[model samples]
Target: MMKNYHNSSLSLPRRYAITAVQAAAFFYFLHCSFLPFPAMQFPFPAMQCDLELSQNVIEAYIQIEEDKIEPMQTESPQYMSTWTWAYMQSFQEPSWHRALYKHLLEKLGKCSVLFFPIISKEEFHFTLLTFHKNERKWRHYNPLRSLGHRKEERCIDMARNFVNIVEGWLEYIRPQAQVFIETKKKPTLVKQKEGLPTLVQKDLTPTEELTLNWIMQNPLQFPFEDDMECAQQSVSSLDYGMFVMFYMDKIAQ
Candidate 1:
């Protein structure tokens, strides 16, 4: 499938990136008449933010879908199949094969909170389109803004691979779930450190422990002659400190 797509067309994703030259543009993309969907009344239960989508975005998508249904009644079924595949490809970021590799990661001062436990940002535009999907859970509307571009078959395969990677990470974190569950069942014993007041809990999250351990194991000890700035910091002690507030009972232990 990939080989055939690579050989025949610009692939769905790549073609979608640049203006013009896409398969949809040739086969009456915005050319077909549009059936207007009522403007955002509600995402599911409640209406989203006050901002409605641009008129062009709404009309462009609606017209794109009408032609596929229009052809189903006619004699040209083969063309319809091609059309269906082409439309799906248009949703992907790019119709071309490679990615633009740019180093976006920059260390802004550390932040730890509920939503963002650790905020390591890279240089990329942050899209702000939020919508709740279901009754119980609300998730970010479109996360694809962060993804690299790809051609059609490559895009599909990459999407599947990404989900598999996430599944593996969840599997890896399964054991850590026991920490929270078991902590509630039985109070954990602590081995207090000797001498000074500094202390940290043993049951830090996997990420926290890994970060502290990596810093300790590989000290950022560059020679005075070295000019690298990535490793340097204003407050080295606090920057490397691990916060374990697990034992702190504010009311009175």
Candidate 2:
């Protein structure tokens, strides 16, 4: 008969040591798989470590380049969103629309006129109209003109008609008004007044200075001279009244 042998031949201490070694080896394999050293070799490729290293280097380089770039200088608000900032910058340069509008105004001889009744200041009106020496009647162009019964229901029909007229005029004059390059004057630097308090000063003509002094002296009286020519070319009551009000406001401030 053979002698019976015990299955627990190895001691508990030895089993514990073997289990700890296996656990350590498994964790070491995992670590090497994810973060392998340049000199180390593993059963599987260490793609995770290589990818992370490359991505980190690229991100660092991009951050450095972005930090070196200077901010754009503009009159727009500092905290404006990206799209708004871009839109504002788009209009900063001269455009064809602005050029066309300026040409149209020059051709039309447009002027802003303020009218007030001779006896009363209550009938003050400001109008934008084209001035024509040959034409007997004034041509008033009110883009906001409407025939709607309610004030709020007014539409921009007049404005649309005006735009169509401008387009037709442009087409008619396209051949003669072809775009041509004009030489522009170089910008000159203005010397700052050093060691002086900031003050607003304007160089006025003799006539302007005399008129201003007279207006200041006789703020309430009418500014028109007795001569017929002077009366014909006299300043508008609305303009004179506005100037007086502005002066008073400034004094109060």
Candidate 3:
């Protein structure tokens, strides 16, 4: 019995040619049915000017140059997630953090002063994040409150200002880097305990140990200068996820 012609496969080139022809036919029909006014049908009007003057006719032609400015790109909230995670993992290296700080300041200097890093419970790493103020003043603007998902919103704004955040980190690392490097040469001691974050004490030098002790000894302070202090204090009264608020407010202040 002979195979059906329609069911038989054609050569690759022939198949592509037939597909091209069918696609062209489909488009042509679609154009004819929907777009009655094709470019050919709507011809340009002849450029004719009625000026009875000598050869001194001042002709001015407007030529539009290509736009040099690039269109702004829309990005998802987690666009910097991977890069930020990597950067955070490299926090032990002071040089890496310093380089990133310089780069972020130079590149994101134009970003709003209100823009700051925040780490959600789900997104546990810090990233360059921005929250637009719909119509309120910068001091009154809070993104978490603006987006009405109070239950899902479990984020702590790391700093009131991004500049302050970067500057603070750089300052903290400057004096501690040499000590941290020296301590890192020793064998690391890790102790895992239930209901507690992993404690790594072997990684700290004598100086770092003393510095850490001093930091832990210091009490939390609420400076009068911080604009967000009042708002933060209002929210800090809440029993849950307030640790970050307390810690960041104390350090950043």
Candidate 1 C-alpha lDDT tens digits along 158-241: 334433432343344345545533442312233347653332333433333332333333322211111111111122121100
* Model 3 TM-score (2 dp): 0.24
Q: How close is candidate 2 to the true structure, as a TM-score?
A: 0.16
Regions of model 3 farther than 4 Å from truth: 1-82, 93-95, 108-154, 157-164, 169-253
Candidate closer to the true structure by lDDT (higher is better), 1 or 2: 2
Q: Model 1 off-target regions past 4 Å? A: 1-150, 184-253
Could you estimate the TM-score for every candidate?
Answer: 0.19, 0.16, 0.24
What's the C-alpha lDDT at position 129 in model 2? 22
Per-residue lDDT, model 3, residue 246, is 23
Q: Output the lDDT of residue 36, model 1.
A: 33
The TM-score between candidate 1 and the true structure equals: 0.19
Q: Where is model 2 more than 4 Å wrong at Cα?
A: 1-154, 178-253
Supply the global lDDT for candidate 1: 0.23
lDDT of 2 by residue, 185-248 (tens): 2112233577533333333333323222322332221112111110110232222222211221
C-alpha-based local distance difference test score of model 3? 0.28
Show pairs that collide, candidate 3.
none
RMSD of 2: 37.0
Candidate 2: Cα lDDT at 104: 32
